[model samples]
Target: MDIQHGSGGTYRTLVDESPLSGLQWAVFVLCFLIMFLDGLDTVLIGFLAPYIGAEWKLAKGALTPVFTAGVVGLMIAGCMAGILADRVGRRPLLLAAVAVFGVANLATAYCASLEALVVLRFVTGLGLGAAMPCAVTLVSEYAPARRRAFVITSMYCGYTLGGAAVGWLTPIVAQQHGWRAMFVVGAVLPLALLPWLFWRLPESIGFLAERRRDRGAVAALLSRIVGRQVELPALPEQQKVEGNPLAIILSPAFRMRTGLLWLANGAGLLMTFTLINWLPSFLTFKHVPAQTASLSGASLQAGGAIGALLIGWLMDRFGSRKVVVGTYLGAAVASLLWIAVLDRSSAALLLMGFVAGVLVMGGQTGFQVLATSVYPVAARATGLSWMQSVGRLGGILGIQLAGMGIASDVDPISLLQALAIPALVAAVAAAFLHVTPRHVPGNAAVLKGG
Candidate 1:
């Protein structure tokens, strides 16, 4: 592709056609790793649930709040950070989020009671919540338009793989050392990556173009992405420095699209997180052994990691509308299969669980990619953040619903039936993925490349 000289249009055109540079790859990997750490930190507790219950001699409902606590923190922080990142910047908030979660998780290793566990989980949630929307915004802005879905979805696989790691290693670690050792591993790893994030992570080019007062910083990054010395244009839009950044996403022009996107995502999260946080315990409740239960849960995540890669490719090839709708419907079908034989066989449990993971996680992955494409750069972070914030509410509710099911002695098959409703709603509403952002000055230029 030939480089042109002029305003930021040249920069946008250059990136749209240009091959991804080494620097862009490094940024993707860094985002992937941060999310990987988040996955490990977030899901490790689910794998440890049986052990924790055994050690504390607590009732099933006792751990329900523990499960929802971090997610609630995550819910709050995701909304706050998304809005804040629009005004402040993505890089600093991301770094702070990683450091906060890493240290908080390290502290989680020392919690002795339910109260202490809940408090620390909430703090860690704040960091975990903050990292994701910022990461999504960074990756979406940096990726070229043609390959955007595939690249961002591939990066999200790191998160699913992280959750899978907890499942694969939990039995061994707990058997040899203890469940606390798993938290130690999670704590040490993200903290270790802080320096690399500092050195390698680049702020979103679009963000710099949109927000930075410093021309040299934008020029330096463009040089790296463009693979040579490059003259850059002025910031694409002069900073208005105006009203609440998040309110822009909620403005009337975006009201319908935003609401529907939240509905799809919230429903998706309710389905996926319900399975992830409760699958192991659910299986155990049916008399499956703890070790096997952990493996079954891991299989679900493994399927999700694999499914995300496949769904992303299909989305890039076929478009987000079909792929996103199909994924949720697939989850619905898999849930139907589970309802028939769920309580009876161990073989059925793992196989059906894996299928559910693939479709449900893949669908959720599509929602994230679609969100990155939905909003203008001005409120992109807030848009993604709020979408995820609503999703986290679903996750928290999923955990609570599972607890309630357990308390009421609701059978596994019945709960599976209830889970299928959201998948159907998401499938039906996938049409909303094509909704346009509010019309604004320069949106055509900014959205054209995306």
Candidate 2:
């Protein structure tokens, strides 16, 4: 039986049934690279703060606003971009976002004063914030249903890998070429990839079909996916709902899951941003060498990369709920262990960083996968962006408190121990999270209610 000649099938069915194609792989790889850059650019500032501060004779926590500003940009972008992507197309928003962050970061390299850097970092953050959810939404739409979790999670590994790369790259670049040169490195690479991304990146076919424009383009993309020329069937009618997409996500049908998801995401990111933004500084405070501190801090991201892949694989095998809950709980244990062993030796510190990365980073990525699974396509971007926005807010809060604590000479070990609290909260939230059946498209009942 020729499956490509099917008389009737949903886009989901076709993709689920088909073997992974070249176009699919291309989409993944491109999105992966974008995520890689996203991680790199976002983390670059944190890693360079100590150097930047020394040059300016700034106070210990003076860069806190700069850090908070970028996260604010990210939060705002998340609040808006997802809704925008849902209305306009994903491709244009993505392009604009990349351009915005690239240019802003480039400007950051030449910043002559603290105020200028803060404003530019915020602008760059807007681009970084907008890029991630859009990329995730695109990948989810393109992915086969059965492999969606693993595919999205693996794609996200690019983010961790990018962050990890900065650990090694920052020390060398900041030492030899100067810290400004490091920003140039981060800015130039993404800008260089811009033309290629603009040329090759495909808009979501599901988005196209939902909007009922560009059927020819959709068919062309679909044909390439299935490895045969095929006619486009009428897409299954999407369930339409009234009111804002944001309101819809919080409606009765979705309220419970959405709230729990937000809690988990927020708690997870609180721990995430705290560590990523402050770990190097904390190590420096502990009398570790600047270069070694950078490397040790980076171990978090390296571990996260491994964790993302491992957790994604596990989610695909067992289920998201158990895997997520266990991962968060394990992260809590790891966080406690980090406090215990980080004072032992450099090797112990590195080992604990990796272990925490595996669980914490993996668990955080799992929340994204879970979010993508929970919302229907109509609201996926909005749901994701809002969830991310909440998480960004948590990150902002964490950074501020950590900065204040460090400035006041609070114990770094106490802060490290505090990481376990969020992990435990996330674990509790995950335990209560209910997943929609794998066979059913997300929120069919809710949408159909209208």
Which pairs in model 1 have colliding backbones? none
The true-structure Cα RMSD of candidate 1 reads: 3.1
| TM-score on alpha carbons, each prediction | 0.93, 0.94
Worst 10 residues of 1 by lDDT: 441-450
Question: Among these predicted structures, which one has the highest TM-score?
Answer: 2
C-alpha RMSD by candidate, in order? 3.1, 3.7
The residue-level lDDT of candidate 1 at 310 comes to 92
208-285, model 2: which lDDT tens digit per residue? 766666878878888888888768655445333335778868877778888888999999999988888888988888
lDDT of 1: 0.81
Model 1 Cα lDDT, one tens digit per residue, 1-450: 112222345555666677899988998999999888888888888888888898899987678888899889889999999988887889999999999999998898888999999999899999999999999889888888788888888988888899999999999998788878888898999999999999889877776666544667777777888788877544334333445667877887777777888988998998877888888988788788888789888888878888889988888887787888888887887877766655566776677767877898867888788777767776889999999998788888888998899988998667776887889988877765455554544332222322
lDDT of 2 at 256: 80
The lowest-lDDT stretch of 10 consecutive residues in candidate 2 is: 441-450
**Which sections of candidate 2 miss by over 4 Å?**
1-8, 233-243, 435-450
